[model samples]
Target: MKFLKIILATAIVLCIVLVATDYWISHKAEGYLYSKVADIPKNKVGLLLGTSKYIATGGINPYYTYRIDAAVALFKAGKIDYILISGDNSHISYNEPDTFKKDLVKRGIPENKIVLDYAGFRTLDSVIRAKKVFGQYSMTIISQKFHNQRAIYIAKNFDIDAIAFNAKDVTNRYGLKTRLREYLARSKAFMDIVFNVGPKFLGEKIPIG
Candidate 1:
């Protein structure tokens, strides 16, 4: 009977901790959004991170495409000077940054205005790589509002000048599943930054021409 009580207590505590942490991180990310939305500078670059397209489904509106489109809009608006599409280029079979580059070109962003980071295998990698590899201490991180916040938090942690532009709202699409996943991801990203988890690959600091 005592063991059962202890187990229940532990479970309850964990649930509370998870909910509290998720709420804090989500709101923290939201706060950054509120502060930077009206102030996204024209001088800053646009850094669009990548995600999968569910290749088997032939989906058109992947989160990644939306992000790139957001960057393109920023470029067209003259809100940003360049678009640095960074993501997982982990293998010959998987090349997100290249796909992002191609899509940007297709959308009328000049090739010279787009840069790719081959080793940005995760959000942390993208943020850190932005700072160390590309020398982007100040730029606009474009993604879904929930996503941008987490990235913004990490960049600020490293003392970088990162603002987030909430990409065209993606609602009633990913639903609760993606939000739950995002909550969990934000938590993990928070821990990773706190512990200073390094990237899977730290390629040579690619110079931006």
Candidate 2:
């Protein structure tokens, strides 16, 4: 009975510690992203995070639509001069950067003002490479608020002056799942920073000039 009690106590303590750490990390990142367009400062480049246009249910992904919308608003408002679409392109058939470029162009954004990072397989990769590979020291990040917070955390670690312009967020069950997953992601972000994890692939420097 005593052993069981001790085990229960340990588990409870672990849960409490995890929840508190997750909250702290998110709180630290909140100050760097803005939901309102008027609050964000102008930057030469906007790092538009990538997501699949279609969900598993054979429907268009709301996350993808909202992010593109946010990126468009930023460009039209003159808050950002260029956009850098970054995402996983490990497989030729599933190219996120290409998909984003097509949608952005269809929205009347000139193809010349957009750049693609085909090797940005993850958020950490995108944020770090934005500085090391793309030569962008400061830029705006576009994604949902939860995602943007985590990206901003990674940016701070790399000494990149990054801020996020939040895209519209889905508020249903799907959004809840994303928000919950973000807690675990926040913890992983801390570990990645401490261990100094670098991007999987950073080819020849691609200056955004």
Candidate 3:
């Protein structure tokens, strides 16, 4: 009887801790999303980080199109001058930056105004390398709002002048099940930063300028 009571108590306490930590991380991310999307300056450089795919319908994922669109909007709004496409290139077969470049070009964004980083193997790698290798201390981050919130959080922590141009969100029309995992992902992203987690791979230093 005493062991049963102790087990119940442990479970309850763990639930409380999980809820509290999740609440705090979610709230912190809320502030970042709410503030970062506004007041983007005219004529600043912009960065369009990669997503899971660049070939799915809606022309290579709504996230990719929206990111390109956001950068284009900033350019038309006179808020940015150049766009940097960064993502995984650990192997020749999996080329994210190239896909980004091709799509942006197809959308009429000039090739000369875009640069590619083929070594950004993950979110942390993209943002950090954008600063360390690409020399972007300040720039607009373009992606879906939920995803951009994480980017904004990382950028702020890294002391970059990062704002967001939220890409369009694909609805739960397919099924709400997809978003269900975001809860855990959000929590993990927070821990990833708090714990200073390193990327799966960090290739040789690439040029920034």
Candidate 4:
């Protein structure tokens, strides 16, 4: 009985520690990013994060749609001169960068002004490569608030000045799962930063200017 009690106490403490750590990291990031467009500082480039257009149920993914819309808004407002669409292109058929490129063009962003990073398989890759590969020291990031905060945290670690332009958030059932997952992601991001985790791939330098 004593052993079981000790195990239960340890598990409870671990859970509380995890929750507190996630909350603290998230709060730190929230202070740096601009949730509103009027407050966002202009940068030469905007980093558009990628998500699949279609969910497993074949319904349109709200996150994908909202991110593209936010990127378009930033461009039309003249708040950003160029856009870097970053995402996974792990397989021939699963090209996230091209998907964002096609959608952004259709939304009226000129093709020449759009750059694609096909190797942004993870948020860490996208944020780090935005500096290392694309040569962008400062840029606006477009994504949902939770995601933007995490990305901004990563950017701050690498001395990249990044602000977020929040996309319209989905508040439905789907959003709940994502929000929960974000806690775990934030915890992992803290560990990644502590360990100085680099991107999985860093090819030759690709200048955006």
Tens-digit per-residue lDDT, 1-209, candidate 2: 99999999998987786688687767878778898888899999999998999988999999999999999999999999999999989987999999999999999899999999998888999999999999999999999988888898889888999999999999999888888787778777788988999999877899996
> Residue 136 lDDT in model 1?
82
Q: How high a TM-score does candidate 4 get?
A: 0.94
lDDT of 1 by residue, 1-209 (tens): 99999999998987787777777766666545622434666656778888765444676655776777678878888888888877876779888888888878988999998888888777888988888888888888888887887788788878887778877655665645677788678778878877988777666776665
Clashing pairs in 1: none
Would you give me the overall lDDT of model 4? 0.90
**Among all candidates shown, the one with the greatest lDDT:** 2
Local distance difference test, candidate 2: 0.91
List where candidate 1 sits over 4 angstroms from the true fold.
Answer: 1-4, 34-39
Residue pairs in candidate 3 whose N, alpha carbon or C atoms collide under 3 angstroms: 42-78, 42-79, 43-78, 43-79, 43-80, 133-208
Q: Report how far residue 16 has shifted in candidate 2, in Å.
A: 2.8
Per-residue C-alpha lDDT of model 4 across residues 1-209, encoded as one tens digit per residue: 99999999998987786798677767768767776677777999999998898999999999999999899988998999999999999999999999999989999999999999998998999999999999999999989988988898899889998888889999999999999888788878889998999999998999987
**TM-scores for every predicted model:** 0.87, 0.93, 0.76, 0.94
- By lDDT, is 2 or 4 better? 2
The reply for model 2, stretches above 4 Å from the true place, is 1-14
Off by over 4 Å in 3: 1-26, 29-39, 54-60, 173-178, 199-209
* Candidate 2 Cα deviation (angstroms), residue 133: 0.4
CA error at residue 89 for candidate 3, angstroms: 2.3
Worst 10 residues of 2 by lDDT: 17-26
